[model samples]
Target: MKKILVVCTSGLGTSLAMRLSIERFIRERNLKVKVEHADMGSANFIEADLIIGAKQVISCLSKQNDIETIGLEDIVRRRYIEEQLLNCDTIQTWLKEKEGLR
Candidate 1:
């Protein structure tokens, strides 16, 4: 399964909430993706195909790692988050590949 990490500065409430939102989206879309949460410091230690967070956080991660990332303007907006997930090319390609497997 493709893995995604939802990151925040402290890895507490905000990250957990974002992870839940992403999980709900994944379940609704029937996507074979694993989602997790981490703090900025811990994120570097975890392995994930993709990382999602506030724009600045993602920017910092992008500079530090080669993983694909999605940066959000509004962290708590479900519609916006879903829209970004739908529009992301990496996610779209993975979805297509999964469809072919089925």
Candidate 2:
């Protein structure tokens, strides 16, 4: 399955919120993927298809282009997750494959 990393300042409260939001989106869309959370300072590195986080967290992980990164204004909103991820190729392809089911 595809993997998504949701990052935040400390990867605790705020990041947890984002992870939950993304999880809901994944469930609602019936997408086959996994979502995870990490802290900007402690994430070290990530192994996933996409990384979603605030500007700060994204900046920290920007050096690694191997993993795609999406910046978010707010970490706990489905709208933000949808807006940022909709145009992503990973999401696009996944959605295309699942479109018939929906």
Candidate 3:
């Protein structure tokens, strides 16, 4: 499985919301990915193959870590989140490699 970290401003509300939404998305699609939620302050401590977040983690906290990131302009909308995620070639490639590893 792959690790996906979802960062939010408060690290609780929006993060939790996105976690739930992404969990449903991953489950319904049968994707072998593990998603975790946290605040940007704790981003450096969280290790993930892909870091998914709004502006904070992408533009701000990104410099703290060397991990690849996916920025979300609208975290509340599931459509935009799914669209952004679907368009990420990094995640796609990782998924393929993970499948191969299996």
Between candidates 1 and 2, which one is better according to lDDT?
1
Better of 2 and 3 by TM-score: 2
Q: Candidates' TM-scores?
A: 0.90, 0.83, 0.82
Model 3, span 3-100: residue lDDT tens = 88888876888889988878887777678889999988897787787778886557887464456788888888988888887788766786577678
* Candidate 2 residue pairs that clash: none
10 residues in a row with least lDDT, candidate 2: 60-69
Model 3 compared with the native: what TM-score?
A: 0.82
List ranges where model 3 is wrong by over 4 Å: 64-66, 97-102
Cα lDDT tens digits for candidate 1, 9-74 = 999998999898899989997888999999999998888888899888877763545677899989
Residues 24-96 of candidate 2 have per-residue lDDT tens digits of 8889888889998888865657678888888767886656656667888766667977877887777887899
Best by lDDT: 1
For residue 39, model 1's alpha carbon misses the true position, in angstroms, by: 0.2
> What are the clash counts of all predictions, listed in order?
0, 0, 0
